[model samples]
Target chain A: MSEFLGLYPYWVVIFLMMTGFYIVISRGNLIKKVIGLNIFQSSVFLLYISIGKVSGATAPITAEGFEVYGNPLPSVLILTAIVVGVATTSVALALVVRIREAYNTIEEDEIKDEIRTQGAGP
Target chain B: MTPSTDLLTALILTLLVGTAVAVVRMRGLFPALMLMGIFSLLGASWMLVLDAPDVAFTEAAVGAGVSTILGLTALALTARRAKTSSRKPWPALVIVTITGAALVYGMSDAPGVGDPAAPASKYPVPSYVERTDHDIHIPNVVTAVLASYRGFDTLGETVVIFTAGIAVLALIGGVAVSVRNTGPAGGRAGDGQGGDQPDELARGVEPAA
Candidate 1:
């Protein structure tokens, strides 16, 4: 039970990561794939934050009589990661829109089929 | 970790896992997007439980808020339902299982949650936490470390976001312009001899003239 308590968070992280990976690989919809990627990234953020935690620490605010503080480095790093994740999501969605406009379908297989047919000509 | 905090984290993790599975199983794109928002919100809550309020704040704002709106906008521009995949998922399942096993194996070596002696807390982090009072004097060590020590990385991250925004604007903006140009002009031209020309180009049936 103690060991389980110690490592359960990491197990959750792994579960989330694999779920996202499965979605990214199995889904045909471009948007669904993007959503999967977002889940995967968020899980990574959770992993980092989990590592930075200190049991008795509150927020990383330096105050009188407070000895333990969670590591601020991971939080700071993850702030940048969160912004990057947003930017990447927006860019990916924009590309999906453009793909839909060009091919009229966002299905991965259909897009591939269309490309093959177009390349082979009438 | 205290029993209460541990229980809370476990509950949130269970919800997060359930949401992720639901997201993968759902067929409708809109509902999946909503689930994705809920997933982010739950993730933010978990972060809060882990004592990283700053991370929780950003995750709530950016992950749940901005990403969901962007997803809705993209869905409006695309199909509502994901085409059912015909391919066998066994290969993906095998791969995911292997990856999960490897990660689990790796986790055995990782330090427990909030372990003070963990390598992550050893070197520069302690220095940052110790000196924040004397050097930066900011109450929030996160803000001080982010703004003072890692300012360059944050600046680069901002520039990357700016560039991505510009790229999205260029792509989506160009599509909107082409759409508008083709709509009215193609309608007008369709009434004339050149009607077939713009209509064909607008539909991407032919190369633009």
Candidate 2:
């Protein structure tokens, strides 16, 4: 039971990851797909942060009588990852807008249907 | 970890999972977007509980703040409710189940939370923690490592963000101009012909019609 308690967060991370994956695969809405991808990325962030944590340790700030500190490397790495995620999301949303403007619809099947009607070969 | 903190973490994780599930199940696009915002906020709080304040800060700012706004802007350009797909989702379900099982199998080997012997806690992490006060003098070792020790990587990340900003500006800027050019009275006709030309040029693709 204590073992489960110690590791429950990782299981939650996995569940979130699978949910994101399922949404990305099954959802037709482009914006929803982006949201799913964001969820996927955020779960990864959680995994890394959880790995970096040290029991009985405080935040990694230097001060008097503070010996134990959580690993700072993962936090720094995740900061970069979070910024990259936002940038990727913005670019993806821009592409979605462009797709809407050109295709007249954001639904994947409809876009494919339009392309087929136009006699555009896949 | 203390029992109370463990309980709090469990509660927060439950909220995160519930919000994520709700975001997936909600059909209304606006509500789903709002739920995504809530999801990010929960993720940020979870990060705070995990002892990663910098990550929590970035998650709150970017995930909850910027990404939600960007999603709304994109939705405004498109439709409100997502068009429901008629295709069967069985194949997706199978794939997701397989991937999830594989991930869970892999997790068995992962070190338990706060295991001091975990690879992440050894080597460079301890090195960084030890040398930070001497080399960077910053109170926050995360910032010191981000800005100094791994400065080049952060710079590369900044360049990537800058490029993305430029791409968005170029793509959306054309639409803004077209909207202004054709005012409200011109309406659909203005969108059909010349209004779309700039967008096509911006995308470097010919307009469909």
Candidate 3:
């Protein structure tokens, strides 16, 4: 079990990704769907951090007293990803707000109905 | 040497199977989303075990962070519940099964896990370790791979971000204006519901009037 605990992170991330993907693809409520997306993205972060871990190494800094250092590359990549993630989230939220204003309902089918109605005469 | 290794292996196996089943079985979008987060967390740990921190981090951020958020955003504009259609999702299942089987079969030709003499360590890694002092000062191989080997690709990604930002500004008519209390014509109905929705959302789910 202990050994399994160590690898628990990897499988967890994969599970989260798949689950989140399913939610995003299948869900009806817009906000709930976003929550699922967040979960999926967070799993990737876990995967990255797990990769960076070293058995007995220290932080990746090379300060004067530093001897052993774990990997720093993962952290760097994650930082970039975080920035991009935040940007994408804000943009998505903005779109959602626009969608609400245009359709008055967040439901996908409802919006589709509205569009269809608009497309048809009167 | 210890039974702990066996236990760890079992636990991981169980989690892998459980996560897959849960993801497959989940009908609602919310719970499924949460489960996805769990899956990513597991995948991150798996990367760690493989001693591929850089890859793990990328997966965590891009896969779990950005992808999840983007997906949820799209979902937010749609519906919350899932409806199972009469059409079976058989094609996707078949593809996934075949790919998985093929990957497992291909693993037979790969080096054993943690093998010191693996080509990965022996070939490019050793050269990087030796020549890094002269070529690039960065000690991290992943950094070298990204900033040096794939520098052009990184630049292209930056340009994509810039383009997306500009596109949003132009299409959405610039920054969001403050929601006014005034109604559509000059009065109450629009003032009550119109301003309130955006405000409530901004306030983090306070009930809208």
Best by DockQ: 1
B52-103 in candidate 1: lDDT tens per residue?
9998999999999999999998876676788798989999999999999999
Which residue pairs of candidate 2 clash?
Answer: none
User: After superposition, which runs of candidate 3 have C-alpha atoms over 4 Å from their true positions?
Assistant: A1-122, B1-10, B163-209
Q: In candidate 3, what are the lDDT values of residues B1-209, reduced to their tens digit?
A: 13663456357546755875676566665566566566665665555454556656665666556656655544443344455434345554555456445534443354433334544434444454345445777666557656776677567657767766765555344324323322233344336777544433333222122
Residue A30, model 1: lDDT of 96
DockQ of each: 0.81, 0.78, 0.16
Give the winner by DockQ: 1 or 2: 1
Identify the leading candidate in terms of lDDT.
1
True-structure lDDT of candidate 1: 0.87
Pick by DockQ: 2 or 3, better one: 2
The iRMS of the candidates, in order, is 1.0, 1.1, 6.4
Candidate 1 interface RMSD, angstroms, 1 decimal: 1.0
Model 3: per-residue Cα lDDT at residue A63? 38
Q: Is candidate 2 or candidate 3 better by lDDT?
A: 2
lDDT of each: 0.87, 0.85, 0.53
User: In candidate 3 chain B, where is summed lDDT lowest over 10 consecutive residues?
Assistant: B200-209
